[model samples]
Target: MRNLFFLCAFLLLAVACKSPEARRPVQRSSGSFIKESAERNKKLYKKEEAIINKIIAQNSDKDFESNPNGFWYFYNVKDTLSTVMPKYGDVVTFTYDVKNLEGTTIVSEKEIGLQQYQVDQSNQELISGIREGLKVMKEGETVTFLFPSYKAFGYYGIEEKLGANVPIQSTITLRSIESSEEN
Candidate 1:
């Protein structure tokens, strides 16, 4: 009888006590964090713009055209007669070479073989620069895209595959793009 009385009292006490987490309301302010993050990203974007501008000015051979996404590009070679271009979901095959600000080669099509990508068609997503640039070119055109890390490969720098990091601008040439449907 005494043991039962103690057990009942313990259970009652436990039930009366509130959880610590429940008692304290969360203090984090989502809006403040978001505002701060946006400011930081804006600064990063500006730095990238500066780097891209410098590269464009230094290269005399390439006449760059800017895009809203903060990259600049120029056609090294383009088909004057072909009007057909790659569209979304179209499979595109081309050769490319990836290089960094210092003109160091990151990867070359010669090292790998003809690269194949479906236009905005893959769950395996290509970088923003490549996808957007492809949309602008005809099958026989070759475009050189100059963009910052954010457009190429942000913070996570293609460590093993392509070694890229922010503040580092890269230039990639879409040597030749042919739609799979054409073949």
Candidate 2:
């Protein structure tokens, strides 16, 4: 009986020490959550687009052009002669003001003050809409951009001032563009 017990103990230990097997999850995730989240975002963007379209319709006088980046803009002051636009490594100085769709000012030009940003480089934190808009602007040009919530603030918005996922309007004045080649 003692020998049998010893043998049983050794067998148990050997079995326990055998290479561990990966335990399969009882219920595998079907990725429904991700799909649902994506669907929700699609609906939200569609609704926001409709609202932006309505605003554009109301302001027929202003030429609001749709951007491929899912924002809209119209030139407040277009620079026709200057074909120069900021490219990668170029530093651009500009001032911008943020407003809601209802034309309420969230941030004034004075509050934002002067901004110096390096094009296509992560030197400064800027909204995606503004970043894309700047690439298309000529020096001394002032463009009013209408950005969707995703382009403006997305999930995280300006603290205390702008709520999450809020669409906004920003008018950027491209004061100067220092060419990288010049540097």
Q: What 10-residue stretch in candidate 2 is worst by lDDT?
A: 118-127
Which one is best on TM-score? 2
The model with the greatest lDDT is 2
Q: Which ranges in model 1 have alpha carbons more than 4 Å from their true place? A: 1-27, 160-164, 167-183
Residue-wise lDDT of candidate 1 within 1-183, one digit each (tens)?
A: 999999999999998895665555568665988899779878888887887787888897777899886678888776789777777667777666677767677777577566678777676556777777777777766677877777778767676866535543333344445556644
Q: Tens digit of lDDT per residue, candidate 2, span 5-116? A: 9999999999999998899999999999999999989998998999999999999999989988899999999988999999998999999999998989999999999999
Cα lDDT, all candidates: 0.71, 0.93
> What would you estimate as the lDDT of candidate 1?
0.71
> Candidate 2, residue 145: CA error in Å?
0.2
Q: Which ten-residue region of model 1 has the weakest summed lDDT?
A: 167-176
Q: Can you list the residue pairs that collide in candidate 2?
A: none
Residue 116 displacement in candidate 2 (angstroms): 0.9
Candidate 2: which stretches are off by over 4 Å? 1-13, 25-27
TM-score of each: 0.73, 0.89
| lDDT measured at residue 127 in model 2 versus the true structure, 0 to 100 | 91
